[model samples]
Target: MQDEPILKVVNLKKQYGPGCQWCSNGHESIFEKNRCLRCGTVYACNDLSFELYPGEILGVVGESGSGKSTMMKCLYFDEEVTSGAAYIGTYDDGETNVFQQSSQQKRHIRNTILGMVYQNPVLGLKMDFSSIGNIAEKMIAAGDRHVERMENRSKELLTHVHIPLARIKDEPKKFSGGMQQRVQIAKALSNQPPILLLDEVTTGLDLSVQASVLDLIKTIQQKFGISMIVVSHDLAVIRMLADRTIVMLDGKIIEQGLTDQILENPQHAYTQQLVYSLI
Candidate 1:
């Protein structure tokens, strides 16, 4: 791992609804889990902060409504953050807070510097577009105008993700869940981004298919040396992929460390429950 982080996030916060004085004044007493009982405001992500190192897979494990997915959405610009700062080592010398960038700048960053694969393939791929077309679309967004180059790159990525060349021209809508997810993975990698955000990418797949996708992800990371943040509720997934793990609960990171360390010696009660459940 590199000494400096490839991506750094500081005090990232995302919430829904306006906060009441009780919740806004740093009083946890007025909140129920991550929601403010008094004002009905939901703190979907509360002061999340983490770093992603080059060539490392960082696992974020949390149950439903725990804000892990919300955090990914905020990082990928799918949802606006209420407040926080993020710096990318390759963007502007890692000095600018990406959240404060203009929409155009953010779009540029999304298209070129970062890639995201949504848990639902529909959210990531244009289902009706040919699988290759979906990949070309992302390349085009990044200002690649050479049609031949796009096609070649798309084919290369698709093949790398284990999408059969014979089916490259087919629309994702006609694919099985596993195939669609593989196409989504190919599309996300079309830009050759330094950072990849995978939000529960294998959630609904069968066990065998999920294993295939996981192995593909590991292979991609090793081959491309891409830094990735993989969010999943499954500890088994985390163990298989992440070099480091961050355990989240109720919108906060309750524990984090080397994946093996966290698994073997879970300090938090919630993390212990998660670890023991894998037994």
Candidate 2:
């Protein structure tokens, strides 16, 4: 791994409501999990900090309300963060904080620097558009104007993700869950982004399909050397793909280290419960 991080997120926070005196003063005793009992403010993500090294897969494991998805949304710009900064090494030499960028600049970053695959295929793919058309849409968003080139690129990416040539022009709504996820992967890769964010991409799939999707993700990482942050509640999934792991609970990261080390010797109680449950 490179010494310099490909992506760095510092003290990132996302909250749902205005804080009251008890929560605003940094009093943890009055809060219920991540919420202020007195004010009903939900701290969806609290002071999250992490880094993604070049060509490395960073796994973020947490339960349903653990803020993993919230953090992913903040990173992908799907939702605005309440505070904190993220620096992309490829963007402005890692000198600019992406959260502070203008809407146009954020769009540029989303289109060219980062690719996101949501847990829901509906969020990533245009269900009515042809699979190839969906890929082309991302390309066009990134300023690609050549029709033939976009078409070729779309075909190449779709094929790479195992989509049948015959179905390349079919709508994603017609595909199986696995196939839809594959199409979403193809669309995400159309811009050849250096950083990919996967938020529970394999959740709700059959075991065989989940394994196929996981294998494809590993293959993509190997082939493209992309740095990825994969968020999932499944420790088994994390063990298969991640080099390093971060364990989150109630909007905070309680433990993090090498995936193997964390699995073998989890330091936090919650992490231990998670690892032991997988046995």
TM-score of every prediction relative to native: 0.99, 0.99
lDDT of candidate 2 over 67-98, digit per residue (tens): 99999989989999999999999999999999
Residue 276 local lDDT, model 1 = 94
lDDT of 2 at 30: 92
Tens digit of lDDT per residue, candidate 1, span 17-76? Answer: 899899988698888899999889998898988999999999999899999999998988
Give, for candidate 1, the lowest lDDT window spanning 10 residues: 23-32
Off by over 4 Å in 2: none
lDDT for position 39 in model 1: 89
